[model samples]
Target: MKLASFRSSIESEIRLGIIVDDVIIDMESWGIEHDLDLPSTMLEFIDLGPAAVKAVSETLKNIDARSLVATSIPLSSAIITAPIPAPRKNIFGIGLNYTEHVAESARTLDTSKELPQQCVIFSKPPTTVIGPGDSIKHNDQVTKQMDWEGELAVIMGKKATHVSKENALDYVFGYTIINDISARDCRRSGQWIVSKGQDTFAPMGPYVITTDELTDPHNLQIITKVNGVEKQNGNTKFMLFNVNDIIEDISEVISLEAGDIIATGTPAGVGAGREPQEFMWPGDVVEITIDKLGTLKNYIVKA
Candidate 1:
């Protein structure tokens, strides 16, 4: 099911919903009307693990079209928010995990040309996250070289520590799209916190698609466009380190909690990697799309 966190255009309260085609079935309203004990928010629902999935499944099965229309909000009219608006901790990011991206980084930026033997990890603070249709701050004072990296983000369902690659996927709650926006010049001291962790740097959501729906995460297509011009076009199959490798590698060192997000690296064709380096400017719009996972669109605005 396509699960989402959204707000009604007429209200400020954030609510969870299930997307059926273009309409959003307000889970909170449905639960209340049916007397089902459903969690109020996406985070709470994720923490419930399989039980929550089961509950939602049952809800989908029992919900009829007439009832759906009465309680549902038009997805086009709702304000889609980040699947986890305020993450419990920084989001885990993988760097140079795509062979072509590694090569591009080596040519345009100060990144290693050699492929990583293990996952290269970094963290993006929760403040960096914004939902679909939001704006990405192009603060010239902060960064003159603003770039985009389209990636697949993983959402964990439960706590996982020292999990094996074979079992790593068992902890996943769902998958979502993330535009890992970066400030190319801010990789000072070879660190990304200042470069990639700025507010509005991460454009995520549209909604989260549960694991059962998208069984093969690595086979999806990831594309990014700037102002309607295609900039980055690649596929998840190009990932140097797959999702399982990333989860197992990270879990060996740090515990991954429920609702924790991991941006599983991006494919090639970043602006910085072009023949003449390209960057986003105020008024620019970026749209990232991944197969199975819907497109996430954001506008670049002056900060």
Candidate 2:
């Protein structure tokens, strides 16, 4: 099921809900209807695991659309906070999982530094995460070349360590869309922290979709459009290192807890790879869509 976070108005508290068709079924309301004690905070639900998800699924199945409150809230209701508003740890992201992206990034530097036998991992601070429809703060003074990397992010369902490729996907709770926004200049400085961890750089979720509904994770199409122009387009089938390998590689080192997100990297056609280079500017709207996982759109504004 598609899960989302939304606020009715600026004065309203952020709420977690499941998106059924065009309607937002508030989790709290569902909890009240079913007599289940709902999570008071977003962080609490992240730890709720399968039981919470099952409860949500069952609740949605029983609710009648006519009986629910249909307030007609706009997509930009108030602010869409990250589905997991505050994760316990920083998010783990992979770089150059798509072969074309690897080749494009390699040309600027040494070609020898191209492909790795293993997944190249990096971390984005939890603070950088924002929800779909949120504005991406473009700090002009620090970065003139801001780019968007549309990726399919895997959300871990259970704690995992030393997981094998066969059992890696079994541990996945769901999937979501992540726009791995980057500052090209900061990234070229040898350290990725500043380039990736800027505030509001990471745009994740309109909802987290459970794995049961998404049967074939590798067969989805991923696309990114900037200001209505299609830019990045590719499928998960092209990934150099698939999802299972990534889990095995990372699990060998650090233990992945529930709610920890793993961004599986983006495809080719980044701004930096263009002929003259086309980067994000103020007022640019980036829309990222992954088949089955719904679309996530965000606007870029001057910091």
| Alpha-carbon RMSD to native, per candidate | 1.2, 2.3
lDDT of 2 by residue, 1-303 (tens): 876777876688888776667666666666776678887455566578878777767766787755466423434443566788667789999987888888877765233345778888899998899988789999899999899999999989889899999999988888989999988888654667788889998999877788767756898899999999999999998888888889989999999988899999999989987777889999999999999887899999999
Q: All candidates' lDDT scores?
A: 0.90, 0.82
lDDT of 1 by residue, 166-209 (tens): 99899999999999999999998898889999999988998899
TM-score of decoy 2 = 0.92
TM-score of each: 0.97, 0.92
Checking candidate 2 for backbone clashes, the offending pairs are none
Model 2 is weakest, by summed lDDT over 10 consecutive residues, at: 70-79
Model 2 stretches astray by more than 4 angstroms:
40-42, 65-67, 70-79, 109-113
The top-ranked prediction according to TM-score is 1
